[model samples]
Target: MGKGHTSANGGSRTEGYQYDINEKSILGDEWCSMYSTTAPIKFEKSHFETAMMHLIREPNINSTAILRADILREAVFEIEPNGKPKVKEEKTQDLEVTDPEAKKIGIDDLDVRVAPTNPLLNLHVVIQIVRRIIPRNLYKDAIMNQTCLIMNSSSSKPSTSLVVYTPHIKAEDECPFYIPHVKAVGILFHNNVLSVHYIPFDNVELLRDESQRAVRTAWRLLQTAYKHSMGIMEGYEKRVNHDQVVDKVDFQDCYIAFKKRYSKFLVDNWAESTDPKKHVFEDIAIAAFLFELWKKIYGKDFKEKIQFKDLGCGNGALCYILISEGIRGKGIDARRRKSWSIYPPDVQAALKEQVIVPSLLLRPHPEVRKRIPHLEHNGGLFPVKVAHELIAPATIVYSSEDLLQSPQVNVTEFSPDTFIIGNHSDELTCWIPLLGYPFIVIPCCSHNFSGERVRFNVRKSTLQSSSKSLGNSTYAGLVDHVEYIANRVGWKVEKEMLRIPSTRNAAIIGYENPFLDQFPTQEVYDVIIEDGGPDNWIQNTMALMKRNPRSH
Candidate 1:
């Protein structure tokens, strides 16, 4: 939410709220459209009215609470022309002050007799009361009426339809501006049906197109805007869960405490000047999640005992947090980040710079043969020389014995119970499951055999194909691919949408290592070999390894 420059309730200018409604980029217009999409909820007309009453009164706690708490960052109520209400912003800010003349009304005082006609109009005055992300003069068309009708006219449809609306403000205007008001409607009709309607203002489109094209030098502006809109639309839909948890982990208390401490430390230290809020909070969330997961798996005192290796640990922030919590872990990445140097000496020592090549890919050398005589190996060609600077480690066919030996055939080797953490691990997304250890992967980039971003054809289930589907994006397909690989390797998988600061928050957790016992280990390898021919697993694994000039 942007801060408002003036006070509407005759309070001090600094006391006013900010309206942060910046949807111009999403809608491709110089002026933000008063656009809203509808959702059909299950309820009778009377029931809907009751819900609406509750929603308007305590909207911060309603179904759309997250949007309010996150995106809007505040709850806004319509003020009758003559009536006043005390204002409250969801997040506490330095500029917040009370409007003494405004009398606050409780849910009991709210009149739900009329159906709210336009959400844009309903929240317009209050939105202007604080900050405006859009220009006030730009959408003079959206504010024809000052107040939104509490009750719909006598003939309006009943409880199932839900509409969400907000107005646009101008960049130049510090105060309220009104003119030709236009409204965009979203109708969620019968049987969970939905329709979004936007009024196309001719001049507005021309202004946006011409102005944006002039300023945007890159070709991705339009593509980025399209993706942004798609993401927002997807957010409006109800989330579906594909993996069910066999064992539950509760880390809410740990997360809350850690978040507070971590956030304060970040602000005080301030390593990266450019926007650390989102990244800082997200790393903290991951910390809390990992802590809880470890507690569940190894009992409450499981800290140093459960070792971890964070593959593709960008910035090594998570490694620092985990180590501070008394967990012994090392983070491996191809490239070291600047933020790594900012950590204390002890914390810095835990982060390692090396690309992790799965031991299954490398060929056995004399060192392995001498040290571990019982280690079994199958024949595979070593990496071919390319530009001579880089080396693509060959795929070393392994029996269960090699896994136990912890062979240093490549960059690093894993211990028996070492848990793998692939937090936004791009190329390593699919390899985590094949390593045959308990792991949790939160995939970010979509990549394939050649370490390239490629989309895989999704094999949707019968139910998913027939149902009202939220079509999969490249990211979602990648998540599915990771889950599929986990299943192929005989791992019991569970997925969770982590409570984090970023949009890419889904995690595929391979907690149950089905191949942990001797019989199943060989059985799982046999299935992998049979699935493709004996060499098929190697080919598939190699294709995903990042190729370089050193290994043509």
Candidate 2:
């Protein structure tokens, strides 16, 4: 009989030739399809029946009836070498059999003697039986089947193993696959990759430390530059006044000037008052500071040669200082001559010899002429006596009996290089710069372009703004207004804390460099026109000239 005709149980074949079932071939073709069908079939009987039917139905069946019958029996259960029922202990192990094509296959030995046998074990035995009966190629195709399973595995659980037949395993390039380790949190890339690093949020403190270091370095450079500029000024002063003593510098001059200007208060209160030295010390300190500041900004070349015109120059103390320093200077006021008469003997002699008395007071009223008998014969009276008494020039200039009521002064004749200095120029602060000279006005009243009285309006605006009040007095507002006007006209201005009597401690310093382009001359002219004619001390003198043409 042929190999397909006998049922092989271990080393023994059946005595009667029986047909062997092609169980492997049937299972390879129909296993997946039969499993998917909805029809119910008895697990025990249908396993053998299905295998037999598949073999019989094959058009190319070569096996005889006896061989097919034997194959069908083997499809249901494996047998032992003897015809006796197999013992459970002997049949538990799998049986290894060589097929006709010399390919090795495993079959599970069936144990019919075992009580209450497991169906899953029986099923495993039947599957092995099918493998032994099928062709090698068919068995290879059947073994290549793939399956996927999902389970609720924890992070610590091992991954399920994938069984792949060696010949059926796919290449890495065929379809890429990745296995990821579980993490608390991670970054995923498009390529199924993850990164492991991160940055913290508290790095701003590092940036702040770097910025502070840079600022400190910049401040040090600025201070160094300032000190270097001051040193240059000191060197220049030494060179310029080599013959003069150190006490004769503008700083010392400012001190003497302040004392001379406010001598009345000094003499009357200097000895009797407490803190007599305080005023002198304050003046020296302020002057020293001003000298240093000026030197740092504009070198020492200009201060010694700078020409100054003191408008409303009361007693000409500041002008005297500038002149004594060899600065080309001139002073004007309705009271300059009057102030000279009240000067101590030495100051009065120095003033009479050195300064020119250009314009004199015109006493339009008989009462004023009676007070100074020289006015009727000479078209003007000296200002030394008036400033000595601290008398207001407005009382004389605006007197009703004056030939020209509201008499005005013209300052143009006083030289183009002049910088008009209105030190405590009361009403003249509003009028001095309008005389076509560059000006530094320390104002003393609130008189405006129009003769309207300006009251303290501090609540309306800031003291920095022109409309606001500077202080409780008219003098304070006038100083504020002058500062506002100078800024409006594009003058580079500096406000200094002046060392002078009266708490109105502001001083303005203005310089005009001929090298600089001329200011809007037409605008300045319009301002002069708008201010209703120049009424400065010189302009008022000119008005006196025009009134009595032959007086000079």
Which one wins on lDDT? 1
Q: How far in Å is the alpha carbon of 457 misplaced in model 2? A: 4.6
* lDDT (C-alpha, whole model) for all candidates: 0.48, 0.34
- Which sections of candidate 2 miss by over 4 Å? 1-298, 336-410, 436-438, 450-453, 456-476, 512-520, 525-552
**Residue-by-residue lDDT tens digits, candidate 1, 178-286:** 2122232222222332222233334344222312321121112212222233444444343544213322213444554566556677656656544677777788878
How far is 178's C-alpha from truth in model 1 (Å)? 27
Over 4 Å off in model 1, which ranges?
Answer: 1-43, 46-237, 240-252, 267-274, 363-381, 384-412, 449-452, 462-470, 519-552
What is candidate 1's TM-score against the reference? 0.51
The TM-score obtained by model 2 is: 0.34
lDDT of 1 at 510: 79
Report the C-alpha lDDT of model 2 over 1-552, residue by residue, as the tens digit: 112222243111222211112222111221110001112212222222233233322211321111111121122233456523332422122333323332221223222211111122121222211112322132232211111111111211221111000111233222101101111111111111111111112332221221233222222222322233334434422211110112223443344344444544433433222343554344333334444444544467657534656655554444444454445665555433433454345444433222111221232233445688765423442221122247554423333223223323331335555566666555456655445456656555555543334543332354444323234355555555565556555566656545344455566655543422444334554554564533344333333322311100
